[model samples]
Target: MNRRTYLYAISFAIFAGRFVHGAEPSSIRVLVWDEQQREQRQAYGDQFLGEAIASHLASLPGIVVKTATLTSPDHGLSDATLDATDVVVWWFVERVVSRVQQGRLALVTLHSAHWSKPFVRLMQERAKSDALQQIPEAERATARIEYLNDQPYGKVPKADAPLAPALTRTATGWSLVLPGCIFPAYRPDGALGHLTTLLVDHPIAKDLPKQWDIPQTEMYNEPFHVPTPDAVVFEERWDKGEHFRSGCVWKVGKGTVFYFRPGHETYPVFKQREPLRVIENAARWLGGEVRKNAP
Candidate 1:
């Protein structure tokens, strides 16, 4: 071949290799892990809760989804599995968020996941962040964390009871305190919950109603003891007037963490159209899979 033609052929081959190897379209990978506790049958019926969620995500374009259970080998969280997943729907436990802190993936923490280790660690970091800003640098080393809630888990305080609020300042530095995760009370007989959009402009709230009702769900009163969220997108309220900040988000490291508070394994909350939409929307937003111009 002529010299120019030989050069052109080499360049074309190089370009083809780059296109084939480096330009593969990336698909968002989702792992839904449910404890698959029998209680979930009350709401999910035959399908496990995690399976139900995974089934919904699989239907979306460009999403590659899988479901794992506590029964799975390595509890469904082997290094290989987590390394391949982009977003995790956790129904129990906490180690996954450490991966999130490292910017490997974003986390969508669900209801009652408030007690999850990742959520607690995030709040602790947030509390320390808040306290550090308020105190002098000289006191940084001696800052103390005092546990405020002395009671056992699931103990609900009276509505009028005093809450051990967050970020209490002290003479040396500051006191990092948080109230109990559970409210003072809950009515298991069930009540109709009204969810009001608190931040309508947020991507997670896209296509949602101004207000929607959960026909029958248990109640959780407020004073939800976590660090102040970066945004509260939805607030849930019961007919009796008890209320909770049901949807909260925080930016952690290079990704975001979202806590959605509607599911109660025994309740069919996830089966509802709106709640399912919320989960799907949240997954897309957190995974950076949403297209800028797509409606």
Candidate 2:
């Protein structure tokens, strides 16, 4: 671990000690939201992928886990669920974004969830935030912001297309191109993916190896059409030379969002130690940080 990683780990330890000693809530409330697609059954057997993850988290100390799926009432995102949650893992729903932005909950999106509504909307919100920073401080209040629509879903971006989350000066103010939230290309042939920790010191990369490989996983090539991430914790490359920023994090409004790109419904990616560790670390760190700052 690098210096940053070391410091963050120490800080987390201190906070964790506090939690155990009664400084705050003893357990982090986690909600695992899975779409529960039939394809997931191939790798997960009887339980859906989300349930598998929730089960693991529930077994860990300092975390209370709940499983929710699309078939559940209110799509399993009832107000009670959100109110009790500190972090939401996997999948997405429209209502969760406001809770995230308000610092009431953090989000961890996995794999194909890159296109999920909450992730897309948060990226757009970040794009707008980035656009405003370019304006003169004095003019920001009066500057008009216009957001362009995202690229069509499943539409692969041309290599030469202007990257999304781009901004241009407009006659009135700024024209912002929302993040495509998609990538240029992908191959789902269950190729081996070599992953390297790019930000070893980041809290999300805590206790993770500097280099690892996914025995069988899909590949997504860059340029991922999203705003520059606040931090990229891990990067992945395939034997064919395609690469992607596999783990990215951003701060939108008062909360944090992390995207982990490794799961494929047909692959047992989440069953691996590293991916699960990443999610566990994110859940604990995000939940702890939010509570430490909560009023």
Candidate 3:
């Protein structure tokens, strides 16, 4: 064969190899959880959840999530289940899983924390302390409205507080929040870290809200212990709860977890722009790709 012909063939061969060796795309095994509580479902909206989330993630390429709720056998996260789970979006857990089991999980808490997990009440209480109380009155006003809106769920022993009058309008089943103050936390770090300092110009926070300026939603505030935060990606102000205040994930061991705090909007999580992006960003983050470009 002629030298030029051979060279051309070799170049073509190299291009083919490059195409073959390109990333196969990371696989994500997500376990969508639910505790099957009437109150929880009532709050989160059941009709549109599964397909909406599944289709959204599926469109991202190379990500797959298998859903299971609180009522599923073993809540659908069996030893076999864990073998595939890359990120677990915990819908709600009414009971605590063993530490060994918990270790395997990278959790995301949705809405009012539909299920009771360890330190739940404590987490809520801490978020409502003097620290969170100091947020602007407008923020407090919003939370009060959400609490009032949610009160129709059920009646628990009243805390007898400032937000009480709003509850008078509360209906019945079980409104998730109590008096609906800022979300309490078991925040070990204790404040919102500057996203600029924490993220170091990561893409994940590339398009994040400068101050989470979204409106008409609940607030998630600080006093959180983000495990190994290289960056503070998000801080939810005026959110109804604390879990979403510290929504992030750093490397724990070999695997990664994206701990999302929002998702309280009923029916579909995506209906809300903030929750949708958070969920999408989280899924992409776990995949080791550029969803945020959010430094």
lDDT of 2 by residue, 120-215 (tens): 778888888888898889989988878787544556678788888777887887888788688878898999999999999999899999999999
Off by over 4 Å in 3: 1-25, 36-51, 84-105, 111-200, 206-213, 220-230, 239-246, 250-257, 265-269, 289-295
Candidate 3: residue 142 lDDT (0-100):
54
TM-scores, all models, native as reference: 0.79, 0.87, 0.47
Question: Cα RMSD to native, each candidate?
Answer: 13.9, 7.7, 19.0
Q: List the residue pairs that clash in candidate 1.
A: 156-184, 157-184
Best by TM-score: 2
When sorted by lDDT, best at the front, the candidate numbers are 2, 1, 3
How far does residue 236 in candidate 2 sit from its true spot (Å)? Answer: 0.4
Writing each residue's lDDT as its tens digit, candidate 3 over 75-188 gives 565544544344333312321222212233333444444222322322332323332344455555555423322222223233232332122223432232333222233232
Best by lDDT: 2
Q: All candidates' lDDT scores? A: 0.62, 0.73, 0.37
lDDT measured at residue 40 in model 3 versus the true structure, 0 to 100: 29
lDDT of 3 at 92: 25
Expressed as tens digits, the lDDT of each residue in 164-231 for candidate 1 is: 44567656545655545445655766578999998998999999999999887777778777667899
